[model samples]
Target: MRLMDSSEAITIKDVRSARRRLEGSARVTPLLEDPHLNAIAGRRVLVKAECLQRTGAFKFRGAWSALTALGEGARERGVITYSSGNHAQGIAHAAEELGIPATIVMPDDAPALKLANTRGYGAEVVLYDRAGGQSREEIGNRLAEARGLTPVLPYDEPLVIAGQGTAGLEIAGQARAMGVTKAEVLVCCGGGGLSAGMAVALAAEAPGLRVRTVEPAGFDDTARSLAAGERLGNEPGASSICDAILTPMPGELTFPILSRLAGPGLAVTDDEVLRTMGLAFQRLKLVTEPGGAVALAAALFHGAELADGPVVALISGGNVDTAMFRRALDMLDAAEPGAA
Candidate 1:
């Protein structure tokens, strides 16, 4: 599919329309505050709890927007997509609600909870082996063609980006309500969909706000791309514990907006992510998957380098497996000198 020019692709108007479309379906998640987080950052910290969103991630907003925009004929043909987990569940859930058939191409080793949740949403699950050199995009595309199904791209399309932008609208409004006029907004970056979409929305709704993309250390493709002023891909052997945000590169449709409006990208280590996850549980009383906690991690660990006043971190998902959550807590304990 051809990528749309950022200038004409999606706008704040589109995001508003998506918000209207999702009025009854998508919950307007709360913007949470914690004094401990603020003390750590030495500034006010507001967390956008998108982990409470339907399907346990923010991906549902885009999936619903894209699926709902399809014409009757297209919806009848069904839809196909590829996601590590969140987007898979998002599309599957949306498809089920709209009475459309859905198929998801997912990694074979994706977190067991996410895998089970995706299937629980009633979508056919097609698994690909990451270690065996399998490509999800190729598989999804081939299946789409063979089955006459429409492909719902995870982050590369205008509609999807606009849908994701709705979250930014909420953040802007919520921050304003909390008397924050100027702040730095940190969004978890996978293929740059959420970050790029928020960039566009914030540019229009809250011009005083600055946006930053957060990623895992080794998979900072969006960070490198933003610095180089061109799209860049991660190394072939790149890997991270934050599997939910591990895309090869920034999306073609998302990079332009991010390049124009987003501030510098921030990267955090796996250990930092684990610590942040533990912190969320202990302090915020929230369950955040590792990828979802990267922005919070950046806020806690790298806030000094970010803007002043207030920092808004997007907790993008909460679909972590039980074993993974236990391991993260274990890592946090091991890092504490006096911990058992």
Candidate 2:
């Protein structure tokens, strides 16, 4: 079995098709003013709540759009995928909705809550060693071929990127209606799906706005790759508290468009993300996972240029554990917002 590459690229046509395919399925998460955090940044910040999306994350939009885009014959054959967490649950839930069987390969140390949720959606789970997790593409392709299942990639497909782009589309629409004209939209990065997608949609819809992507500092292969103007991988591996953003590099399907739309990339520390997550919970009364808090963290601490105007922050997910959330809050409470 051969591991396939992503679709050629992201385009307006693909985004439109994805929007049509996922119309009734994916939730249109809100983009609203977060006055409390706005005052902190001294900038008008509005958060796009992908955290409230179905499956508690934005992955569902991409998965559902991709799955629904499949031909009738392909849907009948079922689907296979590999994911550490969010994408696993997303593919599982999307597969269930489409009446397609799903087989998800997950790392053994993958969060139990996510693993259980994936299983609950009727996906067959195969746990591999976390330290030695092999090429997910190779594994997924093998299983897909063996069982005549369709391989649904998490971030490397045109349909997936287009679907994820809808988050940006919504942000643009809502932001404009709210009287926001010059926004700098920031989105968290993983394999570049959400950031890439949002960048495309934002470029198309909010042409004047700048779209920046934020990633976990050490695990920011996408940023490095974008900076070097080449496809680079996190050769050694990714180690970060924001587990979901630990992807190695940018997706083949998303690169061209991201390079076109996403002006540049930025990175933040795990501590910064955790601190932002605590701030989000306390100030917005929203539960945000570390992976989702990167955008907010960047704007709060590093967005000095846009620190005066309307800034749209995409809160990508909210799947943190209770204990972790409490601990992050405690630690953030202990930290000085400014200290020597």
Candidate 3:
């Protein structure tokens, strides 16, 4: 149980105390915007959505900020992790609304509607064998040490990266109430917990907002471990229909907070994440899930590696199924014949 150790010092006051313990238990989700994705990313894109959060994704604000910041005798001695489905239904619906007792460890090629909605939020899933290498974090730390439990680390801990940086503090106050002083956000990452917890809450509340991280192409190991500054790995059988951001590396505490607050990491292309999950269900109806449309497929096909302001992105999950949302509306009606 002595797990946390990547220097443990998450800041932005632990994402504003996990957004004041997720005010009324998380769900500030929407940010949307769409002028046909801002005229196809010529700028101003937005999106945040978080797959309409709540158990749909954004890993339930770091699984309810790591199980209500534990320690009521470690939430009654029950918890455990490892996921391949929106943090296993955000730690099985925040350990069944705090009654605790979870135990995910999924990935038998997950996404059977996220293993039946993580067993309909009752937890106790345990599948393993992700393409046979087999380790859902060593079978969720050997069944959380044979059931003593308490682990909730779906992304290098620190209260689950300050509960995924409270959705980057609600996307920096909804992109500064949409006046958006400056932008680039884009997240859909994997083991680098919500893009290193939204680049440590947009480097402390939108320092002209940055955070990047999308991924998919051969599980772009956090976009080549943020272009080889160190941590790298994903190639041993490398596969991806965007299986929830695929993770083969990038987490020893989310790579030094995504190499000191991210940017320069993007990869997309499971056919551009099924055409950005068919352009987020034909223009903002939203329902993404090829690993949440790889940050809106890098805000609609990597606009020349971005950098002129206004982007956002972050659709991070929607659970998807039904023949993969009918192959993402048949690849957005073969790339927009009548636009799906």
Number of the predicted model whose lDDT against the real structure is largest:
1
The sequence of per-residue lDDT tens digits that candidate 3 reaches over residues 75-192 is 7888888878888788888889889888888878777888998899898887878776776777777888887897777787888788788888888898898899578888887788
Itemize residue pairs with steric clashes in candidate 1: none
Task: Please list the C-alpha lDDT of all candidates, in the order they appear.
Answer: 0.89, 0.80, 0.81
The C-alpha local distance difference test score for the whole of candidate 2 amounts to: 0.80
Candidate 1 C-alpha lDDT tens digits along 200-306: 89999999888999999989999999999999898888678898999989988899889999999999999889989988887888899999999999999897679
Q: What residue runs in model 1 are displaced by over 4 Å at the alpha carbon?
A: 1-8, 335-340
Q: Report the candidate with higher lDDT, 2 versus 3.
A: 3
Tens-place lDDT digits, model 2, residues 280-309: 877777888888889988888776634357
Candidate 1 whole-model C-alpha lDDT, 0 to 1: 0.89
After TM-score superposition, what is the CA distance of residue 313 in candidate 3 from its true location, in Å? 1.2
Cα TM-score of candidate 3: 0.37
| TM-score to true structure, per model | 0.96, 0.93, 0.37
lDDT of 1 at 56: 82
